[model samples]
Target: MSADGGGHLKMYILIRESVPTGFAVLAAAHASLAAYLKFRDAPEVAEWLSGPFYKAVCKVTDEEFEKAKAFEDHVVLTESALGGQEVAIAFKPRREWPKAFRFYRLYRS
Candidate 1:
């Protein structure tokens, strides 16, 4: 653990420029180095975040930010109370994500 007792495991909130309605949360566990992310449609991930297993989400890393291109594995159109829009979230396993190098550190969001 770090001096603050903060493990390498962390959470970040992801909002896509394409779908801005909601946020995606990414979670990394301390011991196992297992990363879990939150997605609206992926009930398993949502359920995991709903429990105490989550460390943090929606965090802006201390390092600089790297912009990612907009890519859609799947898209959905929503009809929420506010308006008709599409929103989605993603959880990334460590293996599935690439090293996001910013100012000095690596980030997933």
Candidate 2:
């Protein structure tokens, strides 16, 4: 929150889940800086077969704190380098090939 109590960056993450129970929510935030977090244990086939999924709970409160601090101080999301995600995830845009010639034209005697 700012002097007037307003957040700068808001984020929404998408994960696959389906259960008769209910919705799942999670977050971690700082006093006035930033935050980040994740939600899981949806009880879907994958969740159960994968991790014995069940009812979830809040793992981190005041989440956005870290992200807010990072933006305030201009830090990068390199935690993936540490252990979050495998690096080297590069995207090379597809190249368009040149148009093909309809037919060959030549002079003959």
Candidate 3:
């Protein structure tokens, strides 16, 4: 979308809750950068980059991360230290926010 009719581009970054604060931040960063690079050419992402880029960092359990990977439009971040665990997930920017993500709140730490 072109940020018209109140449809703004937004990316959701979900990180594993059990990870340390530093690791969580790193994972979230990795996810965000990966998503941006992957979708940078899209019109919505380009608009977001040109204007105010919006992102939401949320906490997700390991189970949640696993489930989220099933989504087609997601980028997963893996960490070897965590035993090749999926540390974070970044969903492609969408005009309509997915209802599935309603449970995830903003990252506190």
By TM-score, the best candidate is 3
lDDT per residue, candidate 2, 1-109, as tens digits?
A: 2221222221211111210112212111111111111112222223333432221111112233222233221212222323542111111111121121011111111
Candidate 2 lands at a TM-score of 0.15
Models 1 onward score TM values of 0.26, 0.15, 0.85
Per-candidate Cα lDDT values, in order, are: 0.29, 0.19, 0.80
What TM-score does candidate 1 reach?
Answer: 0.26
Candidate 2: residue 80 Cα off by (Å): 23
State the number of backbone clashes in model 1. Answer: 3
Give per-residue lDDT, candidate 2, residue 49.
34
Candidate 2: deviation at residue 79, Å?
22
Give the C-alpha miss distance for residue 82 in model 1, angstroms.
3.5
Instruction: Report how far residue 23 has shifted in candidate 1, in Å.
Output: 9.0
Instruction: For candidate 2, give the lDDT of residue 90.
Output: 11
The alpha-carbon deviation from the true structure for residue 5 of candidate 3, after best TM-score superposition, in angstroms, is: 12
| Candidate 3 lDDT tens digits, 38-71 | 8878887878787677888999888877877776
